[model samples]
Target: MPQSSNVPNGASAAPKAKYNRPKPVVLAVIDGWGVAPHWGGNAVTLAKIPFMNKAMQEFPHTTLQASGEGVGLPPNERGNSEVGHLNIGAGQVVLQYFPSITKAIQDKTFFSNEVILQGINQAKQNGKRVHIIGLVSPGGIHSHIEHLYALLEVAKQQQFTDVCIHAITDGRDTPPFVSQEFLADVTTKTQELGVGSICTVSGRYYSMDRDHRWERVEKSYRAMVEGVGPTAATPEAAVAAAYRDGFSDEFIPPTVIQGPKNTFKPIMDGDTVIFFNFRGDRAREITQALMKPNFEGFDRKKSVSNLYFVGFTYYEEGLPIHVAFRPHNVKKSLSGVISDAGMRQLHVAESEKYAHVTYFFNGGNEQPVKGEDRIVIPSPHVPSFDQVPEMSTVQIADTVIQNINRYDFIVLNFACPDMVGHTGNLRAAIQSCEAVDANLNKIAQAVAQAGGIFAITADHGNVEQMVNPKTGEPDTEHTNNPVPFIVTGNAVVNCQLRSGGILSDVAPTLLHILNIPKPAEMTGSSLLVVQPQVARSAASTL
Candidate 1:
């Protein structure tokens, strides 16, 4: 296993000369908050959000390009949590997984990749079934269906007879009613090839979990192991039932489809499971469920013995795994710079997005920094986030208040708007915005009480533009819109952001506020109105 440290080479990872710690900096990333015209369809504009509104009117604020090529996505592509958070934390534009994976597939490199071939060869040697599992969506958030197609094609070429697919349904990023269609297409494709079968099906909400949500994982385990939850005569019936029950296609509970000869096919021992999702956040826990023996996070009832598991890529460099593709190596993130500058950092976020503030924000490294304080608040456990739009906002605010003065730098992620936005509930989305507003008031005051600076921004746009212009109905997908970037409070730096700033610029700006030089590899420039003392003093007389 390769070891990674936040402290760059030739630089001290801790404080050498306590160079007058500046005022505490409170940086908040309000998930899904965006800038849109004040209209009925705009949730943020329609909601009664006093704090964010006041910041727009009084604080040093500007528009940041959060989606598309602005954040290293393909032209006109919407930004997702994985790329958005990675870019924000890296202080540079990290190429997104979708485009990179697409390129590899187009170039035929992924099909013959050593890691994937190794998995197939090992399966053949051990006389085991090679089972592929991941999110079944083209939304480009988790795993895309195209990746599945490539894997199935490879399986056919290799003449693998014992192949299965466990699809994690998705409706959050795409339309809310397309899981059945997706499954049908995959089932038909696999049948035509005569290589793989759709063995198990469930929603990503239950299987793709972070923050130690064991119950959700157990639900997935039951669906695969015991045919628990809803049962359908066929995949088509299950999709219809999911819609009839008023649940989104993505949030559909675990359902099992009857296999040939009218039998329930469950995942058993000697099965090699490969998670095809390139992004790591949600894939981590479920992958562990299959890979780790004596896994205490959740009880799988029976021991899933002698199972060979692999991820599309080993997400965290610290944890080694046999994977198919090469995961992007994100280095020299803001966390490393902060650690090298010898700043005490606190990362606070609810379970829904805790990894974004800690793991992703630290350049995809899972291990904690030498002097980092991390707090994860559990989100509400419900079928849907709209059930509780005000999800953990108060708890997050309370955490900030309690630890405001303990750390020099506090990074927080509020996950209401984004999580609820995916539910396509206009009322709930508005309420989520209002909830974020109320908590922002509490948090900003806490930052002021601690004599710190408060900087607020968003990963991407979701609740901002609620309605689709064409259909005039609630649009659940994230919008390709600019987000607000505001800086306020006593510790505010005398700085103005350059024109056309993007998410990557945030890390550099935050480091500048703390009197740290940007790493050489960081492509974004600091958006501060003035440069640091070393340069400011030189220019004083010039």
Candidate 2:
């Protein structure tokens, strides 16, 4: 969905005299928090978040449609940390990479990609097998079934004798108990191709831990290398057992696929592994395991020796030698413009979502800006986030308060609600909401003490809508509910924000607060406009 467009310099535009009030702005992004009607399934409404609730009533606030085309994603796509932060930092409706990747596969351009071809040909020349691995779902957030099917077709046409697929099932992105539907489609396609095979299967949570939760990574490592995990006669049986045991597809135990001849194929030396996930965070740890010779993050008891590993995109641009496709690379971001305009920026988040605040936020740039300060508090190294639902919330607030006076622009990400929300634990999720509220109070107070403006917004929605209305059960996936954007400071007094705002509107509003001109490339307009006639008349009468 990315288009070729010219970048504009904000310096050339005339600044609005009435809006010219510069102030240091503290932008707080509450991850996976949303505004919704208080209902049975709405955890945010049920939780005690008095500070946030008061802010909504007393401060200037507006609603933001964080998901779908509001943030420049394909319609109906629920917002994730990646797209949400990226749109916020870019200050515009930048196209996402999902549709482009899907288009490339449909057009058969994926097979012709230079890096992809290089990896495949290298394996063929070395007389080795090509192993394709990714999340096996139709979810457009990470990997999709259509993309996987395209890869299978390409491999068959290339006539590669030995091709294996290692799948990571999902219920977090898709609905629970639907792994069999995806597996059935995969099996039918493989049968039609008359080539390739499914090697191993497991849940994404174990294999895709973004933070250095080595314990979870180790379990997946053992499953792939030592073939040491629960097993079933078939993928259908494994999925059925997972549901019977009260687990979703993403939480299912690893299962090695039994071939038609009852042979289990574990990845060994002289194999090329292509990770098909376009999103970076979840794919980073697993990709590193395969690429690094002496990775100590987790123990790979059996060596996965002499492997050619390739990711759909280089997750970390700092380490750029291990990817098959280049990212869309959003240009002229708000961060870059702020840096260019002589403003010092500070980014803070836990390791679980550090990249989202810095990397994805700044058009996928992994390097720290020369004049910027970045702080990454370590996330709890636990198997499940619900165990300590208040993960790093207090520590993050303390860090922000300590450094509140150091920068012109400060961005903070509270990751607790989103992380715990994914676990579908109502109690833990409520605790997470309270923790976030308390920390927000601390941070907002600190910002006020520093005589700075603080704006509160969220990347997406998760805990706000925790239960499925249809089933009346805990729902782990993100919701399409709009989030709240509240701004408080002397600079924003009597500021009128237009309705129908989205995530992209935040950056422009922040720029307006700082008395900076918005760039022409930014499609989103500033919400701070002229006062309404009714409010003006009331003020005059008073």
Candidate 3:
């Protein structure tokens, strides 16, 4: 018989449910959780996981502010993955290396500046080739093409020789399948300078995600250059503004840019890798595959335990629990006998309602940012009557309920809070939060074995605080949420868990708990060493 969180379980593990605590492997991965570790992002979402809840109780617990305090970005800075992971694993605050380099050159200080740039210039000085590779689009979601140009301009001025720039084609962060025109723009600019600047652009394939195509990106650029009306590129302009101010182009006519990919072909060696993407999910599956892949690629250099996975903006959300009971009423009796605290609401759905749930479009907006947001949209509008979420969840619920403890590490991301905030839709954010809360309670109760330790924290903060749209000032956004880090298992008894911490501390802290060595590069200190006081009242509440 299967049991669910909505219905309590009896005194012990299920008849055949096996709770084997898996090996203590380090699960040091970055998530797109800008909302907060404990409340809005994956941190909170993961908290509701019963298995995690029960596990952490036994382990020690603590909290760290990952984004601002731990990572060392500006206090008010948004949590981007690059800094997040670097601080998480690197053990030190490495400023935006590229931008800092540019500033150094502009101020005539490149010759004597920060160690990071000194390192880049040192690579050049040592006759070690410098390979600057990043996304091709000017969109700031990832690396900006203009930033590459800016870097090139500075490099030439500083007379650092033998610099190669390879632009990776991107559509995932910008349009569906965007044109490589920016590639052309960048190369043309490189050649126009004739300062011995070389460029190459790369991509796995060229096609729009679904129906959107490269042509659309090209057309949008054309419109921008021609000073025509706005299209997909309009709202994107704001993002560009956010990252790089003073980039006021009067929409010059499209310049037919061209280039040769061979000039920039990545050699297996000959140069140190400098990946630059300050504001987007820079590396996805490719980063891991390239670093520690079980497979191989053409002319790819594998990492020697020097693998670095970096990025920006991070990620999930769920709906109300609409479940189906497998084996019909046979589990009904089991359901009644096992409910622990009699704390939840459960009912046998009408036979008609018991049918397998079918998932459909909930009219969820996948990519919610606009081109150039002159006026930040507010989230006051109600979901139209027509909008409906998909339904396959019930099937998933059944399977998870029946077989609770199968995998060692389960990483789930809850995103509705972020989504709701992006729309400036506070109500939706609340609904999303409640939905998350419901889902979490069920999960926590389900997986929380008597001796398990669960850690809950956020990647960043989005839904917690709302910045003013018209004024761009800070406002209370969804309670400016602060997430919880809770451990329910035996490990907690000896664990000195407390509060008043940030984000980057989470990874290293977790790593410390797992007994994994924090690489000298990680900037965060382990929470295990610090005495974390249990907060009588949390920083933020829904």
Candidate 4:
């Protein structure tokens, strides 16, 4: 890639510092690792993580608030990879789309949104059916049951009798068997509102695939628009039968529901669709299958004309779809600042989490900045991550180590712990922790050899707590926990890290060590506790 002198719009000039340091800074984000007080169900405590354990004792470390308001999510909401990476790179609290959509509903602005109204009114005027689709869970990680209800309410208010919901069950973000309760809740709410019926059902594994799994996405598309799947009497029956057939909520095969007149209601030519998912990553592939005119992912089998598709938020740039709420603008990101300073940066991760290290970590910029290099390792194509517990961590570590001397800053993510942790298998989660630890030790040694600084932290908590304390059941959901931040290597000999910090502080601290000035747009301060003598000396020299 050719380097350019043009800087991003919001990027500011990073003035050269008086205190010069030649060694690079490496940030390793150990996803799904968190600190907990209990021993039971705590995989991090149960597993052997020699590198992490020693770093905590030998380095300047502190616990950071990664969940809820600290990461700009709704109060009490658990932190997710999306918001976690955004906060870590933006150096400020980047408000998430969930709270904005919730507030829109609360203030009665949701119903009047132009894109939503256009889809609903067009369907109503054409005497065509309106279809709402999304994950039917209260997990708040991707889609919420409440957001689905709000869209259903729009149908009720518009008096569109021909309304249907395409439900996608979630097991990774919620309890494995809790889909029944969520489907029941949606059924009751639609009944109370006197509108809409569940017309199709599928698991998120088929509908929410982000790994270019065309087969899985095609299954969901055919079920929703072509009615090419097993028939069920009702949504409840579909989930019950799946459970009986030894299929968990996440792996339920796509099934079409039979209507009152003993017929299936496939989406028609003039029908409209509204996907009510707030997050974008898992929703992008399915959205493309539904809305893209020239989609070549798989054969559609049947194509509907004049179908107006609306997404809850922007899935990708330049897609032929309308968005209900646009993303919050994030400027002067850490990557942008580094680029403006003419530093070489490398972002490496497996396909499972490649977007986190680049897109989300760069403040939603899909294109890389000048002097930025990205490497994406292919993840395994297993049915579940537990089958391949490591999931390419060794490859990622090798890539990072090989390029440590070439880049001024390197950002890497290990997807094993978080991806396997979602399976609710304690043994697999433990193995993942061990895998990450072993490779992490290698990367740290290589960084030390390069005479650079090594920083370690996590996005949120998952592998830490495997089982629910109340019911003693396997819990796959993220916890409202704080993650650890540890800094080791030559740059910080006697430096003291601040006691309390959040994910946003990570970027500022890196800039501080690099001797780069933080942009004015960054609200986060450095977590490095500068001694009085050193501070005064630096100030006098400046």
Best by lDDT: 4
**Tens digits of per-residue lDDT for model 4, 1-542:** 21112333323234342345446789999889989986789988888899988988888899999989889889999999999999999999999988888888999999888998899999888888888899999888998888888888877788776788899999988889989899889888878988878989999999999989899999999998888888888888899999999989999999998957224678888789899998888999988887778989998888777788889998887678888898888889999998888787788889888889988999999888777878888888898999999999999999889888877889999999899999999999999999999999999999899888899999999999999999999888898889989888755755789977999999999998778889998899889896887565544322
> Which lDDT tens digits does candidate 1 get at residues 338-427?
877777777888888887888788887888776676778888878679999999888888877777876778888999999999888989
Q: Which residues of candidate 2, in runs, are more than 4 Å off? A: 1-23, 243-246, 259-262, 318-322, 532-542
Report the Cα lDDT for candidate 1: 0.78
| lDDT scores in order | 0.78, 0.79, 0.35, 0.86
Error of 1 at 103 (Å): 1.4
Error of 3 at 538 (Å): 25
RMSD in Å for all candidates = 4.7, 6.2, 17.0, 3.8
lDDT value for model 4: 0.86
How would you encode candidate 2's per-residue C-alpha lDDT over 301-359 as one tens digit per residue? Answer: 77777777778876764443467777766677778767766776778888888888888
